[model samples]
Every structure is written in C-alpha cells, then in structure tokens.
Target: MYDYLVVGSGLFGAVFAHEAMQAGKTVLVLERRDHVGGNVYCETKDGIHIHKYGAHIFHTSYEDIWNYVNQFVKFNNFINSPVAYYQGHLYNLPFNMNTFRELWDIVTPAQAEAIIAVQRRSITGTPKNLEEQAISLVGTDIYMKLIKGYTEKQWGRSCSELPAFIIKRLPVRYTFDNNYFNDRYQGIPIGGYNKLIEALLAGVEVRTGVDYLKERALYRNVAKTIVYTGSIDEYFDYKLGQLEYRGLHFETERLEEVNHQGVAVVNYTERDVPYTRIIEHKHFESGTQPVTYITREYPAEWKRGEEAYYPVNSEQNQRLYQQYAILGRQEQNVIFGGRLAEYKYYDMDDVIKSALECVHKRL
Candidate 1:
C-alpha cells in the first residue's frame, strides 16, 4: 500500500507528493485530466510555448516560495504589464500617471487626484453596489471605461447588480509604473510549467485520465492517507449543496506573423466586445519564433461538467461551502487542499505556499 494517495496532480498535489516522497513515503498521484501540469499546462508550437488553459504569470512576494519554484527550472524576468483597450483608446494599466495622461492629459498626481476627487463626489451616500463602490474609489471615467465592462463580463452581471465589497480597493498608482503585480519575484518557468511538475513528481507514480471519485472507496484502501484536491462538495457527493464558480472559454489562433500583439495580455474594456482579453503566448517568454499564437478569453457561466476557473465567492455560495467544509473536516485520514477544496481564488505562489504549509502541519 502507498503511504499517500494524492488526488488531482495539480500544483498542490504535486507539491504534497514531492514532500511525502522526500520523507521516504510512497505517493500515487491521480490526475483527472490527461496532462500532469494541470491548468498551468503549456503546448509548444513552432518553438513558441502557448499557455493552453490561460496566461499564468508566477508572481509572489514570498522569497521561500520563489526559491522553491526556481529549484526546478530557471525563470526569466517577465513583469506583467498588461495594457487595456477601451473604445479604440489604449491606456497603461494599474491606473498610473501614464493612464491619467492618456485619459485626461494630467501629468502631475495632484491634477489627476483633483479630477478623480471631483468625480468621486457624485456618490451621494454609502456605496450601494459595485458600480457605486468603484466610482467612489476611482471616479466615473475609469469606472465606465476600465472597470465596468470587464467586471460585468467576468461575473455575468452588471456592476450595479454585483456586490459592493467586490470593488473594495481598486489598485491605483501615482507612479508611471505599468507593472501589474507588486511582487518581488515574477516570471514563467524557462520551458513551461510542465518542467516544474515533472521535476516535482520525478519519483512519484502518476496516473492521468483517472477519476478517483468513480472508485474512491477502492482507491482509499490502496494508500494509508488520502490527500484530495478536488471539489470538496463533490467529495461528499454534494450532500449540502453545489457551490458556484465563474468559468472561461478560450479560442486560440495560430497567426502566420512573428508577433500578434506586442504585449502578452491586453484587456478589452468595452461592453460591445464579448471577450475579456487577448493573450499572445510567445510574449510571455520573449520568444522570437517565426509564428505566434493568441487566445481570446470569453467569460462564461460555469456548471458541473465544465471546468471551473474562478470561484463565485457570493454570500450564498460561501455559506454553502461552509456547510461542506464541516463535512470535509470529519473525513478520517483525508485532507482537502487547493483552490477547489477551499473555494478561494489562489495565485500560483499562494497555492505553492499552501501546499508547503499543509505538508509541514499534516505530514
């Protein structure tokens, strides 16, 4: 019998299996998908690595987590400076001086602040919904041109109908910095995320295209402890209720030219446009290949069969997840970890940190 039976060979499962193996434990990693790397999987085309699922930029302030990933593959300096396109106008992201200059020709911070301050005064009382919350934080222009369309498309609802707490803090920068994340370390692995997953599960036995839930009882006896990284609600057969999530559908294209969009990511902040953003894959690694690949991300309503990308952290969903969490905790010798289990939107670094912490505490 194996020491641990790890379900879902994503980053979390890979890390836990790696740790368990390092401590002289046998691990059997079962992935429901066909590949090993999970959502971070990349497909190589014409020497250019294409982010198959979506663009995943590794960024984190935690030094240990940064160092942990670096041991597998070398990372190049790739700062995520995604641009936003609204009504045929291009603006620098993160609401910086460059964006202000493009928006209203305001060079200094005071001038930009004055414009925002004047616009913010339009809010009469406490913010009622996401629309009011956003206008109260960053004024009307940015809200209409930048935030509204994208937010609406993502959650499949208008900003006026969404929760006010969603726009609690829109990251605005006084500096001209276009770098999206404020992390110390940010970049993709040299070849692809597959390299990192391969290195992590070097000795661990992995079976892809295997659905553990189909024969969970049989799999449970194959190992001493079970580390489940799938949906917690599904683990208990959705006894309480089904949690909600926001999904995405990608349409990728192979362009004949060397580069499609100069930048890696571009946000289309227009309500008329159906897709949220377009990601040029080669730009992530600065590849100079002859051909390029681009993917258009269309936000969609999530269901059980479709892949759940982001959790819908609505009050009702959170309440339902809490009921499931209590049931999950009662499972003997079973551990629930990762985004699906916790129902949280986790960055790459956060998932790695969580997996490491789980190993330390449980193992």
Candidate 2:
C-alpha cells in the first residue's frame, strides 16, 4: 500500500510526490497523458525543444521556490521578450518605450506619456466593460492594434462582451526594456522540462495512460492519502455542474530553413490573422539546429473531455468552483491542487509553491 497516490504527473503532483518520497513515504503517481511534465512538457526534434502546450517562461520572485526548482535542473538565461505583430508591423511588448517610439516616433518618455495621457481621456469616470477599462488604461490606439483581436481570440468573446474586472491590470511601462516578466528570476530549464519532471519523480513510482477517476476505487484503496491534480468538478463527476474553460489548438510545423521569425514568440494581434500567436520553438533556447519548428496557437472553445487549458473565470464558474471546493474540503482522504483541480490559472512557479505548501500541510 502506498502512502500517497498522486493523480497527475503535472508540476503540482510531481512536487508533492517528490516531497513525500523524500520523507520516506511510498508514492504512486498516475498520469492520463503518455508522458509527464504536464503542460510544460516539451518534445525534442532535430535538437530543438518544442513547447508542446505553449511558450512557458518560468518567472518568479519567490526566492525559496526558485531555489527549489534549480535543485532538479539547471535553468538557462532565456528571458521572455514576446514581440507583437500587427498589420505587417512588429512592436515591442509590455507597452514599453521602444513600442512607443515605433508607434509614434517618440525618442523621449515625455512624448509617449503626453500621447498616452491624451488618449486615455477618451473614457471618463468608471469604466463599464472590458472595452472601456482597456481604453481608460492604454487608450484606443494600443487597444485596437495590440489588445482587442488577440484578447478576442483568447477568450472567444469581444472585449465589449467581457467583464471589466477581467482585465484589471494591463501593465504599461515607460522603459526601453522589452522583458515581459517583471520577476527577478526567469528562464527555461536547461535541457527541457522533461528532465525536471524526471528528477522530481526520481525513486517515485509513476503510471501513465491511467485516469484515476476511471479506477478511483482500486487506487483509492491502495493509498492512504490521495493527491488529486485533475479537475475538481470531474473528481465529483460534475455532480453540481461543469466548469467552463478556454482551450487552444496548436498547429506545429517544421521549416526547411535554419531560422524562422527570428524570435521565440510573436503575437499576431490582428483579427485577420485567425490565430493569436506563432511560436518559433528553436528560439526558446537559441538552438543552432539545421531546421526550425514553429507552432501557431489557435484559441478555441473548451468542452468536456477536451483538455481544458485556461479556466473561464466567469461569476457562475467561480460559484460552482466554490461549491466544489467545499466538497473537496470535506473529502478527508483527498487533496485537490494545481490549475485544473482548483479551476484557476497558475504560473509554473506558483504551482510548485502551492504543491510544496500542500506537502507541508499534509505531511
């Protein structure tokens, strides 16, 4: 009999299982996917590491969490500097000064500030919806070219239709820096995320191609404590109601040329583009491979049994999740963690931190 049965080989379950193993507890990790590492999983081809899910740049200000990950694998100095492509023009991201110069030929910060201030006055008083909220923050110019279509593609709804609180903070910087994340620690794993997962699951038993809910009784009987990293609503068989999510379909291709698009991530911010962004996989690690691989990320609607990517944090979904959370708390033998289980979005570092906290609380 195992002390802990981890439901998914994702970061949350992997970290908790690793901690449990360190404490000399027997752990069995079950994953529905063929391979591990969850969303951060990468497949290598011709010496290029392609981000299977999407471009994930690990960035965190948490010192202990940063140190904890570095123990498993070495991290590279790859900073996320995603460029936005709009109507045959590319602009630096994060609403920085470089973007301002490209957009309005402004060398000084004052010119950018003056232009933004005048544009922000387009909306007055309290913003009504996502459209007004965005305009009130960055004005109509940036909203049209950078925000509108991209966001529409992501959420499958227009900014006008979405709630204003959805886009509470749109970071606008007046600097020449193009670095997307403001975190002190940021990079990708040296080899790939698979190595990190392998290290984390060292000496721990893992079974892939197995869905816990399908054979919950069998697995639950084998372990004393259950670490569920799958969907919380699904764990309860969607008894109350099904939670909503936004899914993504990736169109990956291998280019004949050595380099394609020059950068790792390029956001297609135009409505005509169809897809939201195109990622050049080789650029993530500056690979000098003979061929290049790129993935065009197309946002789609999420349905049941389809891998839910981003949870749709609508008011109804939140209330439903709260009900599930209450049910989860009452399940004395089970633990619900990670993005999917919690019905919330989490960065890679945040997931690790939460997993560690769970391990501490349980053990």
Candidate 3:
C-alpha cells in the first residue's frame, strides 16, 4: 500500500504528491482525464501550443509560490494586459490613464482625477449594488462601456441584483499601466504547464484515465491515506446539496496566417457579443509560424455532471459549501482541495499557494 493516493492530477494533486514524495513518502497520482496537468494541459497542433482549457496566465504576489513553480519550468515574459472591447471601442484594462484617454480623451492624470472625483461625489450614500459601485468609482462612461454589460453577462444577473461587495473597489490608476494583475511576477512557462507538471512528478507513479471514484474501494484499500482533489460534495454523494459554479465552453480553431489577434486575449465587454473573450494561442508563445490557433470562450451554466469552473459564491451556495466543508472535516483520511474540491474559484497562483499550505499542514 502506498503512503498517499492522490486523486486528480491538477496543480493541487501534483504539488502535494511531489512534496509528499520529497518527504520520503510513497505516493500514487490518479487522473480522471487521459492526460496529466489537469485543466492547465496544452497540446501542439500545426506548430501551435493550444491551451486546451482556458488561457492560464501565471501571476502571483507570493514569492514562495513563485519560486516553487519556477523549479519545474522556465517561464517566459508574458505579461497579461487584456484589452476590453465594448461596442467597437477598445480600452486598456485595469482602468488606467490609457483607458481614460481612450474613453474620454483625457490626456493628463489631473483631468482623470477631477472626473473621477466629481463622479464619486455625485453618488451620495453607500453603494448597494454593482451598478452603484461602478458609478461611484469610475463614473458613467467607463462603467457603461467597460464593466456594465460584461459583468452582467459574466454572472448572468443584472447589476442591481449583484451585491456591491462583489466589486469592493474598481482600481483606477493615474499612471499609464495596463497590466491586469498587480503581481510582482507574471508569465507563462516556456515549454507549457504540462511539461512543468511532468517535471514536478518525475519520479511519482501517475496513472492517467484512472477515475478514483470508479475504483474508490480498491484504491482506498491500497493507500494509507487519501489526498482527494475532486468535488467534496461528490465525495459524500451530494448528501449536502451540490454547490454551483459558472462553467465555460471553449471553441478553438486554427488559421492559415501566422497572426490572428495582436494580443493574446481580447475581451468583448458588450452585451451583444455571445462569447466573453477570444484567445489567440500563438501570441502566448511569441510564435512565428504560418498557422496559428484561436479559441472563443463562452460562459455557460454549470450542471451536476459537468466540470465546474468559477464557483457561484452566492449566499445560498456559500451555506451549502459550508455544510460540505463540515463533512470534509469529519473525514480524517480524506483531503479535499483545488477549486472543484473546495467549491471555490481560485487563480493559478492562489492554487499553488493553497497546495503549499495544504502540504505544510498535512505533512
């Protein structure tokens, strides 16, 4: 029997397995999918490395997590500066001077500051909803063009329905910076995340196309402890109601030309657009090939059987997750983790930091 049976070969599983092995423990990693690296998996087609899942840009403020991931793969300097397109008008994201200039032709920081100050002063009381929050922070023009429709479509709810707390603050910068994440380090791995996972679990025994739940009894009997990174609610057969998540559907295609879009990601913030964003795969790699690939990302409602993406952390869902969490605590041998397991939406950096913390506490 192995010391640990790590289920799901995502970042959480892979990192924990690697660390456990390093601590002189025998670990077995089982992945439900045919491939490893979980959602961060990439494949080369027509000389283009396509992100099979979504575009995962690694950005983290935590230095320990940054240094830890750097051990496996060399990262490229791919700063994520996503462009927002609303009704044929493009603006640099993160509400910077460039965005303000594009939005209102305000050239100076003082002009932008005066505009925002007036807008903030116009809103009298405390903001109650997302619409009020946006108006209070960045004014009507930027809110309407950039945030309103996109956010409404993202959550599939009216701005009035969404709580103001959802957007605590809309970061408005006086400078001309457009980098989305306020992280010290940000980039994609040189070879891709798949290679990084492969390097991380070099010596560990990994079996792809192996569903832990399907072989639950046998696997549990074979391992001394279980490190599960699947849905915690599923582990208990949804005794507590299943937590909700907003799923995404990606439609990918390869083109004959070397370039598709100038940038890696271009978000369509208008309500008219069905898809949220278009990702040009080659831009991530700085590729100079005859053919390039692109993907259209469409947000969808998460079903029971489908893969969960963004957690629907509404009041009801939070309560449901808490109930499942209570059940998780009772299981001494099982370790529930990752976005799916915990029923929480986490960026790549957050997942790494979380995995590190999990490993530290468990072993």
Best by lDDT: 2
Residue pairs clashing in model 2 are none
TM-score of 2: 0.98
Q: Which should have the higher TM-score, number 1 or number 3? A: 1
In candidate 2, position 223 carries an lDDT of 90
Q: What would the per-residue lDDT of candidate 2 be over residues 204-258, giving only the tens digit for each residue?
A: 8989999889987777789988999888988999999899999999999998989
Q: Poorest 10 consecutive residues of model 1 by lDDT?
A: 305-314
Q: What is the lDDT of residue 50 in candidate 3?
A: 91
| Model 3 bad stretches (over 4 Å) | none
User: How many residue pairs clash in all the candidates, one count each?
Assistant: 0, 0, 0
Q: CA lDDT of each candidate?
A: 0.91, 0.92, 0.87
For residues 167-222, write the lDDT of model 3, one tens digit per residue. Answer: 87888889999898899999998978888889879999999998888788778777
Error of model 3, residue 197, in angstroms: 0.8
| Residue lDDT tens for model 1, 1-363 | 998999998899999999999989899999999998889988988888888889999999999998999998999899999999998889989899999999998789999999999999999799999999999999999999999998999999988998888767989998899999999999989998889999999988999999999887678799888999988888888888888888999999999989777999999999889999999999989999898899999999988877888888678898899989888888898989999988988998999999999988876
